[model samples]
Every structure is written in C-alpha cells, then in structure tokens.
Target: MYCAELGISYEIVPTKFDEVKKRPFTDINPNGRCPGAIIQYIIEQYDTEKTLTYNTLQERHHLKQWLQFQMSG
Candidate 1:
C-alpha cells in the first residue's frame, strides 16, 4: 500500500511454506519469518526513494520514538 501510494514499481513473489523454508528465501530471511522482518528488509533494501519512511534526521528520530512507544506500550 505504501509503495502503491508512492507509485513505485513493486512485485509480490508468492511462496509456498515448503519453498519459504528452503534456500534463497532462507538467505534473505534466516529466521524464516514473514511480514515484519520481510517488510523491514524490503524497506531497507528497496525503498530507494524513502517514500514511506522519514527523510530527515529529526523525522528519523521521531519515527524511532514512535516505534519505541509502540513496542513499549
């Protein structure tokens, strides 16, 4: 949705449970988890425009604070 809103070209690779437990996919996610880890990986790796993320240092700090708040409370 964020990528869609930003008009970025993205692809969603579907996977079976067995496939996700194998190589390549395992290389990307050693923990073999979905969603959270995957989303973070995707944003860090592919969000070159920083579309859904903060652009400035201050904004980055604020985002960290918000994430901390969510994690704590």
Candidate 2:
C-alpha cells in the first residue's frame, strides 16, 4: 500500500504469494525478515523524499521503533 502511495512501480507475482507453509521461501530469503521490517526497509529505500515519513532525525528513529513494535506483536 505504501509502495503504491509512494508511486513505486511493482508487479504482483502470484507465484511468490503461494502457500508458504507448503513451499517455504527460506531458500530464497534465508533471513526471512518480518513484515514490519520489510515495510520499514521499503520506506527507507524508496521514500527518499520522505513523503511517508519525516525529515527530523528523531522522527526517523521513532518510526523504526514503531516498526519494531509491530514486529514484536
């Protein structure tokens, strides 16, 4: 959703979303980062203009903390 809102071009590869339990993707992404981490990474890499975030250094850290909280849950 943030990717779309930020105008980042992407495609839906249905095969990638296949049953993970049946066909684990650990072979592809060994680390297997959580959803929040992935989202935060995308925002950091693509939200260069900080449209979805803020320019303040403190705000960025706060965002990361929140992302971690989501991961913990």
Candidate 3:
C-alpha cells in the first residue's frame, strides 16, 4: 500500500519460503523481518526525487524509529 501510494513501481517476485534464508534477498535485506528497513532503503536508493520521503535528517530518523518500533512487536 505504501509503495503504491509512493508511486514506486515494484514486482511481485514469488519465491519459496525457504529461499528467503539464502543469498540474493539477504544481500539486499539482511533480515527478512525488517521489511520496513528494506522499504526505507528502496526509498533512499530509488526515491531520488524525494517523493516517497524527504531528505531531512531528523525526519528520516523519526521515520526509522517508528518503523523499528512497529517491528519490535
């Protein structure tokens, strides 16, 4: 939903559950559970226009903190 709202195009690459613990995906995202982190990374790397997010230090930290809080539980 967030990705769609951001107008960030993405592909639904279906993979086996067991494959998640392997190489390429892990290479991109260290942990599968930290999806929020992955999304943030995507925004940083590809959302160069700052549409999905801004380029402010405090704002980015706050957003990261929020994402971490959500993943904590």
lDDT of each: 0.66, 0.73, 0.73
lDDT of candidate 2 over 8-65, digit per residue (tens): 8888657543443233665555544335766878887998887989988999889888
lDDT of 1: 0.66
Clash count for each candidate, listed in order shown: 0, 0, 0
Off by over 4 Å in 1: 1-40
Tens-digit lDDT track of model 3 for 9-43: 77877788778667887887666444676777777
- Cα displacement (angstroms), candidate 1, residue 25, comes to 19
Ranking by TM-score: 2, 3, 1
Model 1 lDDT per residue over 1-73, tens place = 6467656588987788778667887898775544354445656776787876768899877866765565444
lDDT of 3: 0.73
The parts of candidate 3 lying over 4 Å away from their true place are: 11-34
RMSD of each: 5.3, 3.3, 3.8
- Model 1, residue 42: distance off in Å is 3.5
Listed in order, each prediction's TM-score against the native is 0.42, 0.62, 0.55
